[model samples]
Target: MVTYTGDVTPGGAPDVRDAGGLRITKVAVDEKMSNNCYLLRCRTSGAQVLVDAAAEPDTLLPLIGEAGLTTVVTTHQHWDHHRALKAVVDATGAEVAAGFPDADAITEQTGVEVTRPVRQGDVVRVGEVSLEVITIAGHTPGSIALLYDDPEGHPHLFTGDSLFPGGVGNTFGDEAAFIQLIDEVETKVFQRLPDETWFYPGHGGDSTLGAERPHLAEWRARGW
Candidate 1:
């Protein structure tokens, strides 16, 4: 009995639910209070990927187990993003993964082994889906996104904190380096994807490449 909720944001898009085939369920945890987390599900195989567990395991662990999640992947080493990471790892014995840069910190915090150290061009096979990893280091020195060709739709890009609906993510690392990384993501990743490709961000409601692509120029012009 998966219940659906309406959009609560002022100008945000309505909540979406995929009832069949490959699906993605948004579990708004501390994110609405601070940051957001998502659970990516493959209906065909009943396997899931937990992205950015921002709350306690008691809050999200049940959902993860219910969804039959197999892997936990972090967008970065930000504390808010991995709040329940250790718990999730202990509960499901799920393999934890993160970008290469934050491998050590993630390892320390979770105390759970990192099964895979992802980088650009690397693919993580989740059930039958292959998510091509895209390293976008801006908000954090180790931020990464997932890009995949969906079997049901055009394509999908799970942009951790690298992108959002209105603008790019925060520049917390080296300001100059972060800006350069933003530029790279805009050019190499976003621009390469089809216009209709979906952008599932880490902190906001979903937006399409067409909706976000035009805004990139504006973001760059404003020195984002």
Candidate 2:
């Protein structure tokens, strides 16, 4: 069984590592063009998940180790998120998983080799915890969010560049697609979830589903 060590706000950068029945860590990396990168881990099994591996591999690796990471997960294909993937993969033997659309880019950029291509509806498990994948394709063709049920608390969301604290993730590829993705988030992920769900966004501070739900209509009214 996993225990909660509460939320620790480590000094230096915007990195956070939370340990529940499973572990969830985020390391701030300079997005080549966007924002920060987040690294998540499952403490009990040492299974690691990287939302974006952009930051310095040397600095980031130690933090991952501090959290007892074992694998990596990419949130999108932006250069910032995956720039140091090859180095990290080499060191940890950690298989990288990304959305289906970014598979080609992930393959072309970091040839270290990917273990598998994860898509919507896929569940990545570690020990007794399982992260459910929900594809939100607007910021990038293959942008995916990982959702998990906190065995000890409310459900949590690792929203990679999809939903943020105040607004939403950046849209770089398709405008219509992004708009559609926003709608999908509303009906499928957002509305369907209980109000108590806590969202761990790729950027900015965390927010609760209850607090943010009211703003969805506002985002839609403004054209999303």
Candidate 3:
């Protein structure tokens, strides 16, 4: 697992590292909301994918550099998460992708057409690297996560606002939504993935499945 115990705040430098065969760069775009924007590049082909255009276009655009953005993925239709979507897409002309149910909302908020409506079992290609789309609805009607299985090592999960460090995402006090989120997370993520799998959440610091698995019961009991 790639351990990064650094400052993840807006205006703070990005945390860049090599995991498996890909280059992963994580930056916090919106400081108050702690929204994390990730850039995943396929080392072999240099094809890049920008995940969640959170905020701070000035900071996010510069990070793209010369690699060229191939695609921009919106984890959900949350306004905070897509605050910089228009700017990034306008700069890179990248294809916009989002969950099927949230496509219309994303398009409305960002003013960029959602070219791809991703769903579970769909594979998003970034050069030769492939990311499997996992729909985990709870935080929103169309919340989704991307899973990249590193052939050389553990898998990498970009879990938007679905799963977090101490607990699952806030369900806005809705018990049914909370139940759905927990069920999907436990069934689709925790139970299916290995302990070493690294989950990069939409906000806050990164954590591994192993580190979080033991606290699943506690999280469920507390019912956040």
Candidate 4:
């Protein structure tokens, strides 16, 4: 079964689980906002990457353990998502990466330089594991998702805040932004990936594309 732990506060622990051969850990650093930080480790070479340095560096650093962090990727430039980015980067000395358009905002907010500017189709390597970048706009112009294909299992996607379980992320009531988000999610994500592909979002519990696929029309009709 998939493992899930409570939000990481002063004394809370993180959720740890194994997906196929990759080791995945999630910590809810910002409980009020339910912001999530994920750590993905390659079982073979022990290389690891942190997806979204949400918040609470003291809580997140310990969970990283001895494997060390190879990279820290900010999925978007949202403040809540990168609150602890500078702290984590300072402690781990890991390379900071983010989408091209959002990189400047992230750097300005976190005070940590984004050394790598990733775009759609770019590949990020962590030991033996390879994560492909998929740019999804609307939620944020440079919002991006990472797709990791486990040769022996289904693919896993780390979608920042662009795609969620119930529907596409909130577009701040912008009709055009909402439409753009849905269109990008449907064409770039649902249509291209298999239904079994699992997604670890920026917050809350995880979800599979299959569980969310049937409701595409519903989400679109509601215009959220």
RMSD of each: 3.6, 3.8, 1.7, 2.0
Largest lDDT belongs to which candidate?
Answer: 3
Clashing pairs in 2: 2-21, 25-39, 32-80, 48-70, 48-71, 50-73
**1-224 in candidate 4: lDDT tens per residue?**
64453234423567787766688877777558878788989888888899998888888788787778989999999999998888888888899889999999988988899999999999988888889999998999889999988788889899999988899998999999999999999999999999899888887778899999999999999999
Q: Could you tell me the lDDT of residue 155 within candidate 1?
A: 82
lDDT values, one for every candidate: 0.73, 0.70, 0.90, 0.87
Tens-place lDDT digits, model 2, residues 13-103: 5444464766565545543343455655566666666666765787677877654445578888777677788887777777778888888
Q: Against the correct fold, how does model 1 do in TM-score?
A: 0.86
User: What's the alpha carbon RMSD for model 2?
Assistant: 3.8
Considering every candidate listed, which one attains the maximal TM-score? Answer: 3
Ranking by TM-score: 3, 4, 1, 2
Candidate 1 lDDT tens digits, 84-147? 8878877787887899998788788767667788888887766777778888876777888887
> TM-score for all predictions?
0.86, 0.83, 0.96, 0.94
Work out how many backbone clashes candidate 1 has.
Answer: 2
Window of ten residues with lowest summed lDDT in model 2? 2-11
* Candidate 3: C-alpha lDDT: 0.90
What's the distance in Å from true for residue 136, model 4? 0.3
lDDT string, candidate 3, 68-135, tens digits: 79999999998999999999988999998899999999998878899999989999888889999999
Q: Which candidate, 1 or 4, has the higher lDDT?
A: 4
Model 1: pairs clashing at backbone N, Cα or C within 3 Å: 31-35, 31-36
